[model samples]
Target: MRHDDDGLIAADALDRVTWAMRRAEWAAQAWKDQRLRPLGLAAAQYTLLINVHSDPGLTGAELARRLNVTPQAVASQVTRLEERGHLERRPHPRHRHVQELHLTDAGREILRDADAVIVEIERQIAEKLGPEKTSQLRALLDEVADAVRAP
Candidate 1:
């Protein structure tokens, strides 16, 4: 049995899947190092902040679900953010045992700074891949995400 030199069978769907996974990992690390670390935020923390900003009253469990993480993990990150003065926990309107998450004024300001870093990273990627190709790549990735998330 001869192995393909490219380590992929011709026209194999798994080839694209494997490539996409590796590319995503590499891109995430690069973005984190080049864009997020300088902002004094880890990628997870940044993601949490963005989620809370977008959904200001989400509970810890809701955030975990949205982020595909465990509630404990979300709670830990939330605790850190609250300690940093970037987030606040308020009594849930209807749930006596749960609290809703909100971004503090500092959180909003930090998010704006993070957005600038993200925009700059996107701009750099666009320059490397060109606008048309970058847009196409994003659309293709979105399709992949939708397909993977379909139940």
Candidate 2:
């Protein structure tokens, strides 16, 4: 092993890490492009819709918290979906000014389509990685997330 004159070893480690991150991002975008693009939904919008549909009757603030986005961002997405007739906003039971979101019939139908796309994506990933390795990868990624968030 040769070291640079600056006494820095593992110079390539940084490059490798950068490459890995970019590769993972590219793979994710590719999957989203194939799965969500034809449905007229961006990946972020699809995720928001799915999350809201799964946790119905949640306020925009609550949804923003769960989605780790600003309330305004959630509101913007919700507004678009509402205009498209996929979702609706109603008065919250407890909050006076806050509105709770619900998926309309069309929203549910779109969600089903999105779910099918997601299922196909998962199946393709599983076929490529195999079940055990896929699980292992998930565990390892979770560990990384935990470590990153640790105090």
Candidate 3:
């Protein structure tokens, strides 16, 4: 007797909420890909840059945990960013084996530009969703994420 918003009968696993979440993720990734193409950055790279900008001195292993990626993956991205002069790995203050990440001046400049692009994209999304609904949606998503992370 249950029907989705489209009037189609929904499967138990692929309900309206799940479908919406999946489509939203796909669309957002596609949009980010298009926007970042000219900047020569992928969504993952941009995410890494943003994370490092926000939390300076994070190690590759820490970034891996925060980004939900493998340490090897983080290392690879770190190498790429370092090669581009976007970031550098400095000696950790306490740990001899761990290297802390630091964004370069070039990285900061590029990150500022990337932030503008993301802000514009977010502005468009907010315009469509309206401020109230957009806030509600963000709060709901954060709550869901927190709940999932709860022990």
Query: Which ranges in model 1 have alpha carbons more than 4 Å from their true place?
Result: 1-16
In every candidate, how many clashes are there? Answer: 0, 0, 0
Best by lDDT: 3
Worst 10 residues of 1 by lDDT: 5-14
Off by over 4 Å in 3: 1-10
Q: Select the stronger candidate by lDDT from 1 and 3.
A: 3
**How far out, in Å, is residue 151 in model 3?**
3.1
Ordered from best to worst lDDT, the candidate numbers read: 3, 1, 2
List, residue by residue over 1-151, the lDDT tens digit for candidate 3. 6445564544465667767888999999889879987987777888999999999999999999999999999999889989999999999999898899999998998788888888999999999999999999999999988987899
RMSD of each: 4.0, 4.6, 5.1
lDDT for each residue of candidate 1 in 50-149, tens digit (9 for 90 to 100): 9999889999999999999999999999998999899999999898999999999999988889878877877887899998999998998899889988
Q: Between which residue pairs do clashes occur in model 3?
A: none
What does candidate 1 score on TM? 0.84
Report how far off residue 146 is in candidate 2 (Å): 3.0
Better of 2 and 3 by TM-score: 3
Predicted candidate 2 versus true structure: per-residue lDDT over 1-151, tens digit per residue: 6454564556576578547867986888678767788887777778888887788888888888988999999989998899988889999888788888899999998888988888888888889999999999889888877887899
Candidate 3 total steric clashes: 0
Worst 10 residues of 3 by lDDT: 2-11
